[model samples]
Target chain A: MAMDRTEEDDNLPRRLLDGCQRDFPLTPRPFGALAARLGTTEARVLDAFRDMRKDGLVGRIGAVYRTNTVGSSCLAAIGVPLDRLDEVAALVCSFPEVNHNYEREHAFNLWFVVTAPDQARRDAVLDAIEAQSGLRVLRLPMLEDFHLDLGFKLSWS
Target chain B: MTPDPIDLRIVEATQAGLPLVARPYHAIAERLGLAPDDVMARMARMQDLGAIRRIGAVPNHYRLGWRANGMTVWDVDDARVDALGERIGRLPFVSHCYLRPRRPPSWTYNLFAMVHGRDRAEATRQADLIRAELADACRAGEVLFSTMILKKTGLRIASAAAE
Candidate 1:
């Protein structure tokens, strides 16, 4: 049964969000491959993707680099009050470098990811955030990377 | 191609992981009573078919003292998203980059890139450099350091060795 996507006010873009993730195929014929898997035409797939850009369902699909191999990295967060959460979250998200930022149900309401070349530069990035956002920065670097990569499967159960 | 039961079986076996042993393929073949090379060849084909991405190491950043991870989102003009995204993907620091749709009133990012480092400080710092380089491309940005390490699972491709 086709689930009602109208819960979000009958939005077609929202309905296609999951489908959009499906739209990107790992195969070389990526677009066409994904389209065939989804039982749609490549042109339609392209159009929907183009439409998605105008609408803003995601920022970009790019590589998530490995920290240790490359050079350096860091994780930083701030305790933004609930009221100004969006403002700060937007500020944090506005930076092209800040990828996965979220408001967990906690005092440290605003969280974000930061990357840089070395420790000195990494610290500078944090400093810039503190200066621009004016939120006290709680520096929490990773002791280790236990597990990563949560692959998304578009094949709906 | 049309997927048969054997393909399905392969999928089931590989979902968890390929064994952490030298002869993982042989172990798998033993269960199926097929030659190890046969299993390896099938795996190679299935991987080549895009049913599985790449078989590689997923290091624990924390263990290595490089635990910082960040996802950099970009809001670029629709006209230049793909080109700009391709450029971003090329950077050595960039591991995963892609184009995605942003749902309004809920999410407002159209491009996403991830960066990993030895620790939180290292990750956040790299994010800063990226932001400066992208100063013209994006209007705003922020970094969120992970407070807790979340669930990390292995292959979900259901190839024969994982199960």
Candidate 2:
């Protein structure tokens, strides 16, 4: 559902998206703390979350783990013939380890991120993907992360 | 920081999402039979150790009006990539910047940055700025706009592997 942003209701959703992108309260009553900070009631804050979630605006309210800190991860790409793109993509997406998979315009047309508890396991998944897809997997492990924050401010226009 | 059994349990419970409640930690604590303070403290420690990046809402950028998402890749001088990447990554429009190994013959772009905008034009504008910034250091680059999101999900550590 698209957000019906009126003058009054718009600010809360905008504020909630911008303010709570990171550093959300780690307290027992987090919504209560967020409510106090945002100058709203606990119930109202909870309601906003529910509404936003139902609208598909909010992905989740949870912990974002640091890369390579919790587990090993790599950006992988595979070149599939245009005709077989859908088939290849489905095979790649079958693994739970593959969190993100995208079809981009390139010789290496299919790109995805594979994450596992350790390097060995991550490689194993990649090998399996290559074998199953009948395509060579180009494993590109992150050598360095320059800009890591994935959050962006929302413009309520 | 290696996650203890309790920490793993916490991650498993909340990886999907935190319960939407007044006292989410307390609810999690109840499920695990631990004190609310214990759960909170552990989470705090994890954040401090860089195990947990943050505890917050993750808004879908596409849903939030930034529809054009481009995976801008660059083939830059490997020797100078670290310094150049730092500069490129600092740009407000670039959300994620990373250095990944280049595949020979078929692929040569090693630096990857994701730029987002409300539309294709805005996203391309950002990519142009990045190209200009890189200047002579960049030999070639391509902005592959995502046609579709095939799969998207939060990273879930296998419970069996957690032990």
Q: Model 1: residues >4 Å from true position, as ranges?
A: A1-157, B1-5, B32-35, B157-163
Best of the candidates, TM-score = 2
DockQ-based class of model 1: incorrect
- Per-residue lDDT over A39-150 for candidate 1, one digit per residue giving the tens place of the 0 to 100 score: 5555554555455444433332322223432324555668888788777777776553453465544455666666543477667767888898888776655432322233
Model 2 lDDT per residue over A103-138, tens place: 887788899999887899999999999988889998
Best by lDDT: 2
| Residue A79 alpha-carbon offset, candidate 1, angstroms | 15
**What's candidate 2's DockQ score?**
0.70
Q: TM-scores, in order shown? A: 0.47, 0.93
